[model samples]
Target: MSFTVAIVGRPNVGKSTLFNRLVGKKLALVDDTPGVTRDRRPGDAKLIDLKFTIIDTAGLEEAGPETLEGRMRAQTEAAVDDADLTLFVVDAKFGLTPLDKTFGELLRRSGKPVVLVANKSEARGSDAGFYDAYTLGLGEPVPISAEHGQGMIDLRDAIVEALGEERAFPEADDEAETNIDVRDSDFAGDADEEAEPEYDETKPLRVAIIGRPNAGKSTLINRFLGEDRLLTGPEAGITRDSISVEWEWRDRTIKMFDTAGMRKKARVQEKLEKLSVADALRSIRFAETVVIVFDATIPFEKQDLQLVDLVLREGRAAVLAFNKWDLVEDTQAVLADLREKTERLLPQARGLRAVPISGQTGYGLDKLMQSIIDTDKVWNKRISTARLNRWLDGVQTQHPPPAVSGRRLKLKYMTQVKARPPAFMVSCTRPDALPESYIRYLINGLRADFDIPGVPIRMHFKAGENPFEGRKKKR
Candidate 1:
């Protein structure tokens, strides 16, 4: 079994920076702003040869049970409880505070092995603060600068000493640790006669939930998790970092991402909010399927439409989640209106799936999950070259490409270049003369004829014959 380490401390102590350093990726959002991380985020960490799971948690604070700060503190405490060892981090440049001492006593009572980490020790006056950490009675402070990558060897030695040499390095297992699953779904396809490989059951699907501020993005994810795994409240922008959580539904592994709520570009002026928005966009790019959450009370706001458009442009499979369904007294009427709006406003994502869900009460969650699964299958659907050419013949017969400069464009051949938001390339006599309207016509035909809906379809027109048609083997 792999050892688990949780970094806990007061706000702005470089816990996230240390986590990014150990993970060798910028997986967590780092800023000078305290309390940027409210939920406990986990990553696979390595130090030289030592490997373990590292959790980055919110800043420890004192607040009432109902306040947001109190909820953040609760998450931090839970991380400490679940960890095998705790890295009690402190700001060496700023020295120890009263809250640090209080949390130190708390960790001592828990009886978990604690490693005091004095962060930002590269600063000129950090020696006094590093020495002050010894007074907390945890242990000798391992002085290190998380930002500059200083004293990492000392940190590794301290961890190995805390966990004995044998416990630190366990036997390696041959089984692969699943991250993102890239297997094709079980959706029936007309592309090829040969059977595709079955879905990999062990791999996990990556789904990103995103929308405008106060759309209940976090609440919806928390409802799916059946716990407050994310920091959520009545606040409009409670989440600033895109946090990913691994889960299982009906024996299928899924990795769900809870992203920060986005707002209009003009309204997003703060540096921190911009960082959060960028992080959310990154999640969309990496996700296999994206769930666009909307406030059912005020569905299809301007920003909400912009978000859906962005998802379609990214060529990602998308589903609309109308959150706060419980607030609507007339469900039937509101759902009908929402469906009409989805069709009219989101023409780019034709035939998009929409589910009415109440994040607060867990209503319609099963249906939402089903919609996500179905949409993912559509996203990964593939079409064979022969089937595509046959479909192209029918589409042209129904509506030929418009004539430009009194000469009709002749589409010679068509083939799907790739799946996962199916992209196609067509070789035609006058590629430049083919109007944008004609391209849309062909894309629409592909969606309706091939059962590929709700995902972006890329169709490129190239002049002359297919590039690979006459290529000969050099070997």
Candidate 2:
């Protein structure tokens, strides 16, 4: 097993910054605001030759178990228990506070090996705070500036000392056994006229659950995991960072991302919320499939429609999950009404799959999962060049391209350029003269004919060159 390390500290002590520094990527959100990270996020980190799993946790705080802060503390404690080593971080620029000392004692009592990390040591007048760290009884502090890439060598040495060299750097035979099996077909083929790659079942399917605040996104993900893996409550915007969890569904590896709820732009006045929303958008961009959760009682709000449009524009497969089905008295009528609204308001994503589910009671989750799988297949669907040309012939015959400047436009050929949000390229005369209405008609025809619905389709037209003019005539 890989060695696991957890970064734990009170709020705003640069714990996230330290995590980003160690991982060499900005996986964790860092801001001046306190308590920005509520969920425990794990990433594969490599410090020079030492490779291990690192978890970034919320800043520890003292609060009642019922409050949000207390729940965040519980998450931090769970991370500490799960890790083999804990890096207790402190702000060296401003000495240790009483809360930090209390958590330091708690970490000591937990019996896990602790590595004291004094962040922001590059700043002037931080030596006193670094010296004060010794009073907490956590051993010598490793002074490092996480933001400026300073003292990482000392930090690596400290970690090796804490976990022992054997555990930090395992035998080569032990490390070689962890290689994942990836087939040649798993990678993309040639650049021009490339065949669609087969979906690698061995790889995990990335699905992101996103919606407005308090839309039961976390609850739905927790139900899928069959545990309280994500922090959930009645409060809105409880989750600040997009937390990803991996699990098996029907022997298939699946990774689910629970993102911070996005709100209207006008109401997002705080910089922290804006950062959270941007993170959520990044999740959508990276995800192969997005499950847009909605409150069953308040279905299809204005922001919800806008989010749907955004997802379609991003060229990702989407599924509408109407959560909280148990609250509805008239299930059939409400579902029918929801279907109608989805059709009327979101015509761009025609035939989008909508499933009603109750995150609390675990209703319709199976259907939702099945829908996700089906949408993913459609997103990766590819068509052959010959088949595309045949379909193009039939489509153009029925409804020919309209005339522009008294000359009829001719569509000579068409072929699929790529999939995963199916895109097509068409060769025709005067490509720019084709009206938007005709392009929409052809796109609709392709969607209906190919059975690729709801997912975004891209089509581009190019002017075809005359063969006779380019070469000498046979006569």
Candidate 3:
């Protein structure tokens, strides 16, 4: 019952920027470009004391259903219909344009509470065209800057007035908004304990390709395959099914899973979209490395960032493909921006290999494919028990996994029990209290010393009581 605020505006009106700001993270892709956002994306939005769901719709453009903009229009219209309140944004610096007016008219007719948001009002004389916004007849304009974080107080007050008293938040029932993201079939059905897995079949390495819808995932797959096997389109949701292709690169055969674009689980309503997300998660279970393809035009969107985060949390290897580099302007400046923002935002994905390429033009595709090969090599890497204990001895001397229950928990031994996910069994007492921070240290050391990349790593604990606690040991 939480009132939803749909940020509806024409292309490049700062809707995604505001969405990211409200979400308190750089979840949406923002650039000095127009029409970069396409899907009707919803996220946890906040404005000081106000916490509500915010929907960032694609730019509304004048086009027919056959065109991309027209499809975007359908998504935007659907978002408007689903929301309880709406914010009609306009580029105040560019002055009110016809598209803004058309968007305003559309919102005005919807009978939902509307707030006129005039964005980019931070610079001097920026509001010179504020008067033009009045013609939309949505009421007094809320001049705000999403990038500079200006006028948030006013925006918050306006949001509270619009929907604060309407109803309670719908998500209040769910204690935790489970952030379940990427899934692939390969990640599923791997709990076989007795049957020895064919190392040859499983050792080829598993890779999952994922990102927001229309983030060039299919194009990248096609480029790697050297054929037009997968369907590609500019519209979102072109590839509704996850397809697996078995191929080899330099005698190293690998299983590549091309999955549908993954978004927040709560926002997925369409049947096809749900199936795609489920399949992506399955892939993640088995994929050693997940290559996230992002549209250079709107790279690092909320869904994109979430997808990467899910991989790291699941302890999988990660790579990022900034696809469509050919369409991005000012490559140098953009890379610098990406470095700064990505460092501050995606801390979990620090040190992740990012490759800029155009899947359509084949620019930098070879490098991307090679990087994948190298990362897979790292992913399958293993270390001897002697080398691990040696490294562990050095680490323990430097700093040990502190004491709990006054016992000073000891890590007696460790060994690489399996590959694929690159799992290890640690022989240690009091396994339940092993702090997560210590686990991270062990993971970091393993990755650094063994040089693994883009694969999930599992660390198992075996208490030293006995191989059989109640039963007698082997006679």
For lDDT, the strongest prediction is 2
Model 2 C-alpha lDDT per residue in residues 352-435, reported as the tens digit of each score: 999999999999999999899999888878887888999999998999899998999999988887777888899999999999
* RMSD after CA superposition, every candidate: 4.3, 3.0, 16.1
Tens digit per residue, CA lDDT, model 3, 143-167: 8999999999988777767665445
Q: 26, model 2: CA deviation in Å?
A: 1.3
TM-score for candidate 1: 0.93
Evaluated against the true structure, the overall lDDT of model 2 is: 0.89
Candidate 3's displacement at residue 228, Å, is: 3.6
Q: What is the TM-score of each candidate against the true structure?
A: 0.93, 0.93, 0.52
Task: Count steric clashes of candidate 2.
Answer: 0
In candidate 3, which residue ranges exceed 4 Å CA deviation?
A: 1-206, 245-255, 283-288, 312-316, 339-350, 466-475
Q: Please list all clashing residue pairs in model 2, or write none if there are none.
A: none
Q: Ranking under lDDT, best-scoring first?
A: 2, 1, 3
Candidate 3 minimal-lDDT segment of 10 residues: 192-201
In model 1, which runs have C-alpha deviations exceeding 4 angstroms?
Answer: 176-203, 465-475
Q: Candidate 2: where is the Cα deviation over 4 Å?
A: 173-200, 467-475
Clashes of 3: 22
